[model samples]
Target chain A: MSLAGTGPRRDGPARGRPRSEAVERAIVEGVMKLLEDGVPLAELSIERIARTAGVGKAAIYRRWTGKEQLFVDVMRAAEPPDPELPGTSMRDDLVVLLESLRLRGLAGRTSAILHNVRAQMKSSPRLWTAYHDTVIQPRRRVGLDVLRRGRDNGELRADVDLELLNDMVVGPVLVRTVLRPDAELPADLAERVVDTLLQGLRPS
Target chain B: MSLAGTGPRRDGPARGRPRSEAVERAIVEGVMKLLEDGVPLAELSIERIARTAGVGKAAIYRRWTGKEQLFVDVMRAAEPPDPELPGTSMRDDLVVLLESLRLRGLAGRTSAILHNVRAQMKSSPRLWTAYHDTVIQPRRRVGLDVLRRGRDNGELRADVDLELLNDMVVGPVLVRTVLRPDAELPADLAERVVDTLLQGLRPS
Candidate 1:
């Protein structure tokens, strides 16, 4: 399955040349696949992935530090935020980010990784802590940007609390994805959430 | 620990009395203590509990089916929802629910149970489906009710989309609690979320 491409075999074709990319991609893909299939990461293992991906162990270790690093990296790959979209209106920007889920499976990836991350945190507290500060915090900053822009623009009321609004945006998405994979996230949820944040829930 | 306070005591005096509620309470209390002290539930064997509780295995099993069933029941003991606060105001009602985390450790006990549940979901499809439909749905319904109420009272704009609002509320909470346990659910976070739902997040 290592489609290293059918490049011209220059000189004497090497027999069983190392499928280095196959090994890395396979391991990472295997992790994503298991999670997407709802296999919790705690139950995931190189042995199982080897069986699933038909890749060798030596090949996987050659690239990844271990399961932890590999898992974190795989999660990171799924959430590629657009820095270009920021410095704009918060409502418009968040809608763009939130809509990406429909196209790129962001909600699915986020929900899937969560099970794995949760299991890892329970077993390895120190490692999980470091990962959050380094990995998770950076992602959350995207939400922070939206809030800042909203507050700056009169779209959000001048006195709006950024942190609380951040939670509001994040809480529902996190909760919905984890709780019910089948639940739908509409294209307009972000807009409704932002509107509520600025205007208040009371009728005008 | 088996607090066989109700069981017949074979010792001296009226020790042949049935086990007392005090003894049972002591056993459960000991279990919670060990848990808080970082003792793994897997290590909390009946023998260990009985030894710690000064009771018999008979006393423990007499009350519980087995360790897993018993443990599941124990974890299910998250705090019940508080009495509905009297108010037409959404913010006040939410304060009651969000503050209930300390009252129930949405990030603590529920977290632990969810950890175990995620791990076990791999082996038991039935349990996973049951939890998804039962426990998770019930909680999500609470958030949905808030949305529906906002719409009905016109507290939310007539054109507001409720489904999106529900997701906004649930997603972030799960992400915060499951992914980042140390952060407290901020006091004003609910307000921000509610605000976002009603007003658009934009620079007015």
Candidate 2:
């Protein structure tokens, strides 16, 4: 757990990269531990994280620009790995993407980690913006790309607004995960959301 | 503005009702002013609010159960009045509901009032739950009722889960108002969301 001296050294290219990764992991894990322990984000100073991780402050600063950037990494580390889209069809790809979100919702650790961080981040504009730019927007872009491709391939209505469509498609997952945490996220949630949406809401 | 002596009195039945209403308005507006002035919720005490409103603490306690309940009234006082459903059709009613949300988004003061309150409320489960129970849940019930009515009238697919459908219908608005504040809430947003979902995302 003491990652002090294992940090990357300028002179030691032979093993520096692996040591650097270790230092990075230690720093990120240190943040996760603090959040999981109910430490308020406002009180989580870099010095505290460094002490907890047993690493030098320089080790953390070398990896991230600021607290916001560091928290982004903590979020990324705690998250389930992003789904690898099947690329076979837009519907299939969308299900995979949404399934990843559903899995994230099911993971107790991710929710625990986010519960405090998300609460504080909203009050801090800088932190909220950084999270949106780095974490949310990139994921949004992936969905948009899938939708755009689907439109081109005649799988989607060409006249549709992809941006709005993307929001609609992803809206339910976000609502359940963020707004109504108590709601059941059943195993077939991804399929239910996608299929229900595709079939439309109107009576035939 | 000095509502100290105007509070309801047991002996004065004829004038007591109006005086009580004035006292209530004074207390609610006082809280709004403090919040608008950037007072953190943690620092907002009943004593401080009474002092700010030129009313006795007994006056506030007589009306509200606690700080949580008082804040609920503050939210109510600050909000645009809830949309009156047209009851012409489910689609029209939904459009009116969402249009009200869009207007709330467009209103600078409502956003300003909610900005700090929403951020801090998330950290305080008691306050967040109070607001949800008092404000969010009531609005959600309205939407659910409409969806249920739609299903009964054969305007909605019988297979749809009303709870999830309600979320889907309101999800886009919440995203723009709460999550992505910068997203444009166009005038036609409600119609677009309803029509798009009704038509489905697939190619016709």
Top lDDT: which candidate number? 2
lDDT over C-alpha atoms for residue A75 of model 1: 56
Off by over 4 Å in 1: A1-75, A78-88, A101-135, A179-182, A186-200, B1-24, B34-39, B43-69, B76-84, B87-89, B102-154, B157-164, B170-175, B184-204
lDDT of 1 by residue, A84-147 (tens): 5654566668766555434334444556465455555556765575456556575578778776
Per-residue alpha-carbon lDDT of candidate 2 for residues B1-204, written as tens digits (9 for 90 to 100): 211222223343344567788877888889989998999999999999999999999888777667877877676666678989999989999999989988877774357787667667777899888878778787899999998999999889999989889888988877777678788888899999998878888888
TM-score computed on alpha carbons, candidate 2: 0.86
* Cα lDDT listed for each candidate: 0.56, 0.80
lDDT of 2 by residue, A129-202 (tens): 87778778878999999999999999998898888988888888878887788887889888888888788988
| Backbone collisions counted per model | 49, 0
Give the DockQ of candidate 2: 0.68
Candidate 1 residues B1-204, lDDT tens each? 222332223343332234565555666656656665667665789888877778888776666555654444344443253446546665556545555533344545455544553455444565455444544555556756866775777666676556665565544555556556665666655555544555544444
